[model samples]
Target chain A: MSFFNALLEHTFLQHALFGGLLASLACGVIGSFVVVRRIGYMAGGIAHAILGGMGIAYFLGQQPMSGALISALIAAVIISRVSRVSKHGHHQEDTIISALWAVGMSIGIIFIAKTPGYNVDLMSYLFGNVLMISANDLLLIGLLDGGVLLFTLIYFKQLLALCYDPEFAGLRGIRIEWLNTLLLCMVAITVVILIQIVGLILVIAMLTLPAATARLHATTMLGMMILATALGMMITSGGLLISYNYDLPTGATTALSSGILYLVAALIPQRRHAVK
Target chain B: MPALITLKDVSFSYDDRPILDHVNLTINEHDFLGIVGPNGGGKSTLLKLILGLLTPSTGEISVFGKHPNQVRTRLGYVPQFATFDSAFPITVLDTVLQGRLGKTRSLLGYNKHDHAIAQRAMAETDVESLQKRAMTALSGGQRQRVLIARALACEPEILLLDEPTANIDPHHGESIYELLHRLHERITMILISHDVGFVSRSVTRVACLNRTLVCHATSPVDSDSINHLYSNPVSVIHHDTRLSLEDNL
Candidate 1:
């Protein structure tokens, strides 16, 4: 009762709650695909790579979020393009992804270094500061959530086909490359939206773990999404509660809570249809 | 009936290493073709070419009088069953519904009509009862049948199956072929396999693909052609029966 009272007393706290739920919504829907496609590393690469975009945005005197979003989309295209070019070229794709991962961080570091009078909010970028989440962040999260929901509602089947059987989807004349590019872009967008809650470093964990934990119990993709969203909300809100009461960092505490929840879920024996 | 698929001097190479070399072939309506070749003999590669997963390096291919990709919706595909991720979180029904990918335009969603086709396909494959089961929980044979159901859901004109039983047990493999034989009359099927005896028995035509094509053009493919396909004539011991498998020289 008092927790709700305290949460309602502050607008920033309310924004954090709203933003966290929206982030959960996006993560649950998109993260399900990310887990099934086994694109965790690539998604992580994109999340980290978005920092380069953020850094560049900072250097270029542009709004950092839009710049980050654009660079992440571009990075998504680059990742896909690189993978496509090397599909049969005897090149290991993991190496390419790793290269991009390093390149993104390196570029971000170099740009941050060159940005004169740069305020060091690297902590927020790396770990996150959900307590400081603003109304603008909430609106951005809401809009992104809308787009993601609309996309899933309209193209759920297409996304399912793409993830389950790419070749079959291709043979169905689905224009797999474009759909794939769109999927990667969504991953990038989801990362952009989530950076405030879990930061770039821990983004993949929240994106993947909730879905992965849900997958053990879910018989269908929709079921997985629903369960994951609920779990994400619980973890996020619970993390927020702990942070508020214990004077901890909101995002890290929330992320740590999710990690603990995953362990607990894992420890729970006899989860129906659990993967071996 | 017009040619359903045509490949003209098609060749594919992986980084300068040839997989298919100067291959030319044509398949017509209602043709049940069994493409048999050794490992790395371009049998799967040929199917990929037709599926438009890879463009031929030096030749042209067409499906239903159009570019392979353009007519992909009319052609059903069953990729190697082993490639499926068992832990993927998809229901059998959801997997089958994916076959309706071509029918549902954006915003239209899957109408009841689409579900009807998927249900019929599931019934045809005798997997209707398992519709709600997760994909990973099914047995190998059940999974393969579900895959066929998915392919059939598209109502495709030509069905291409790539090694449907490569990882299946011998008993289950025959049953899988039996299912294919049942659907043979309706859909023109092209099956890629290394099982000469099975191909010889099941298909209307047997094409030997080893960097080139020499089709038997008849059922019950003769031992002579089998011997030619495999330069070194050999036989297999299958369930106490002597099954011949000739290796390409």
Candidate 2:
């Protein structure tokens, strides 16, 4: 059945679409900061590290997504601490991020290996099956989305200062280190929401690609976020239709579409100055 | 002039490598002080210390009769223009308004008074016309001016600049110095510069740093003293005329 026809008939399709919308809210908001601050690599590392959480959760016979959430938040805290310590030292931040990334995936694989049953569902977590998004997953995504939006709204100015120039923010008595850690934690939560739709491997794409595309034309952070969110919704819907039509993987199709859209946006000649 | 900032035997090091050693300096109110030094001579590090961005390994530094961090909001800082990411999406007005961050009390964002202050700062720096423009659309000189405006929006008692004219052309550099000179009438200013000639010509006081510091009144500064501090033959320009240290001596 065509995606449009199935969308009318199937509750799962509706849940998947709603999940995409909720995920995009967090993606557009947090992803804007992540892209502007140039922390996408760190965010990517956090996403990859989530597999370790899933692995441990499965080993403990718990919900894998819950494990992913716990793992993401812990990874964020650890990454922020590592970044702070290594910022002025010989030990580079990216080196540590890469270590965590690899270790997390490796641990996940090991745990899945030890699980008694044939853990065929592990594939869905790695490369997400959006069509499998249950109503419970939608509720979780919604709650996370609300938290991300509220936090971003309250601390928008401080976050802007931090992302633009952290030293200046520190001088302003902004408590930049604590704010940075909180920002990372927010990114971690956003990562979990994104993992539901795009899975761990392709999560960074959904997190960054729309924001990157919006950056080409946005004059302000708020504009970039709003534009990125709208673009994200369109991309998700488009990817879903195309995947259903061609019987392709939904997560990969969404990631591929996001990449193509970003490239296309880059190629288009944009106005040099955004409207005031 | 009353002493506004005082550093007592301040020593700082990075990983046991001494960047600054036993440096003592006092800055007075309404003073335009310039700090000039060789590369890696801890000039920038000193400003960071004063801004409370870095703690000293030893010694006491105080601003406004208190710790630097306690008086941080009262002190403005203009970072090197080269260090900025121009491609970052922000408006000139928004960038300047960041100066009011420390004073902003509400979570709803900048207030009417904040906007008024930012606008006044942009006007003082002659960047009011460019307030609506994207930061990326600005030239190097325009960007420097915008940064100055941002610092000025803080309504600071003392403004600290780290190489305000490092990357801009000579013409823009001169204008920036001119703006700083004008601002000196009301605001105490401390700036680090590599251009010894401009420092000597513009500032009321000059401090030459090279693992140690030598303070000199502007009129009494000479190339021989600077060359001795640098431990290298350096050329010092005065009023567009290039003079080798030996010739000036």
Candidate 3:
């Protein structure tokens, strides 16, 4: 009840609640693809790699989100290119992602340390503070959400085929390598949007949890996406209310909410749909 | 009859190791060719080369008088069952609908024509009844039929199946072969398999690959030659008398 009253009284609280909804849009859509393709680790690596971009932007007195967007796109391209060129396969790709993951963190730490003045927002950036999201951040999140949704609508079939059986897609005249790279680019953008809501640390959790939970019940890909979005909304709003009432960190609370739901869904014994 | 596909002196190597060496073969229109070989004998490599998924290091190949890549849409492919993700959240209808991907151009989604074609393909493959079922819920035999339906939805001139029955029991495997036989009248087929007996019994022609290829009619294939080709004892069963061949390895 107090949380509802605070939502009515505070503009920042409204923005946080609105921001969670917008972030959930991209998370439900792109996150479904990430989970189905089993690329959550790659998304996590992309998420962590954004710190380098944010730190550089802060050091240069520029908006950190812009730097994040640039670095995420660059990291996605580099990772996909390495994956395409490596003859040895996914092991090499995994190694490259780990390297970028650590390197990005170290680079960010050095840049932030060198920046002048007390950088109090560092923890907020690392862990995220949805309450601190400004009007401009809300607008940015909306635009990115639109971009993610549009891309998905336009390339739905191609993306579906790519995820299901890439070799077959290639035979059918889909340029799978380019399509795969474009998908990674989408993942990169999605990571940046999620970063604004959950920060780098919990971005993958937000990206994967709702979609994974939805997978248990969805019968189709589109069904999965829609159900995941609804699930995301529930999880995000539930987390926001809990955090507001208890005075806890909003992002971590939201991620925690999603994780608990996913575990609960998994524990329920589903009738074996698969044949032996 | 003119050849539907022609390969002249094709050789493919991976990282300086040869997989296929100087293989020349011709596939006529309506030919049901079964490819048999030991594991790592380049049988699958030959199929990949023909499908334009891999390039031959030194050879010239042509499909319908053009390059394989140029005519990819006209060739339907059913990959190995082991290669698929059955747990994916897709229905049988949607899986078959992917076969019409080449013809589906609208951004709105698959058109009415696409759905009709997919439906017909499903009916032909006997998976129309299971169109709404989740892919994960289907048995291995059912999944294989769905994959074949997906390929058939392409309305392809030639169908390529890579070990479609590799994971199924002999009962299901025979049923899959029967399904393929029924479709043979309208579409050319190239099948890869380890069951020498079935290949000899089913296909119009058999190609034995052991880093190279030996083309033979079904009637003259003997166990001694096949066992020597595999460098071990191999069982050769005869299921019919229509196709008969025997030779020295």
Report the Cα lDDT for residue A199, model 2: 90
Please provide the root mean square deviation of candidate 3 (C-alpha atoms, Å): 2.3
Clashing pairs in 1: B230-B247, B231-B248, B235-B244, B236-B243
Error of 3 at B15 (Å): 1.7
Best by TM-score: 3
User: Model 3 segments beyond 4 Å from truth?
Assistant: A88-91, A273-276, B238-249
Cα lDDT of model 1 by residue, A5-105, tens digit: 98879888898888888899999999999999898998988988888888888888887789779878988998888777777566777888888888988
Worst 10 residues of 2 chain B by lDDT: B240-249
lDDT value for model 2: 0.90
Model 1 DockQ (Cα-based): 0.55
**Model 2 interface DockQ:** 0.53
Pairwise DockQ winner, candidates 1 and 3: 3
Tell me each candidate's TM-score: 0.91, 0.95, 0.96
Which candidate order results from sorting by DockQ in descending order? Answer: 3, 1, 2
The digit string of per-residue lDDT tens for model 2 on A1-276 reads 767889999998898888888898999999999999989999999999999999999988999989999999999999999999997877789899999999999999999889887675778988898999999999999999999999999999999999998888888889998999999999999999999898989999999999999999998999999999999999888888898889899999999999999999999978874322
Report residue A168 deviation for candidate 1 (angstroms): 1.0
Each candidate's fnat, listed in order, reads 0.75, 0.69, 0.69
lDDT of 3 by residue, B115-192 (tens): 999999999989999999988888899999999999999999999999988889889999998999999998999999
Stretches of candidate 1 off by over 4 Å are A59-62, A88-92, A110-118, A270-276, B105-108, B222-224, B236-249
lDDT by residue (B1-249, candidate 2, tens digit) is 558999999999999899999999999988889888888999999999999889999999999989998999999999986786878999999999999998976667999899999999999999999998889889888988998999999899999999988888899899988999899999999989988777766788988898899898653477688779889887755664665555434
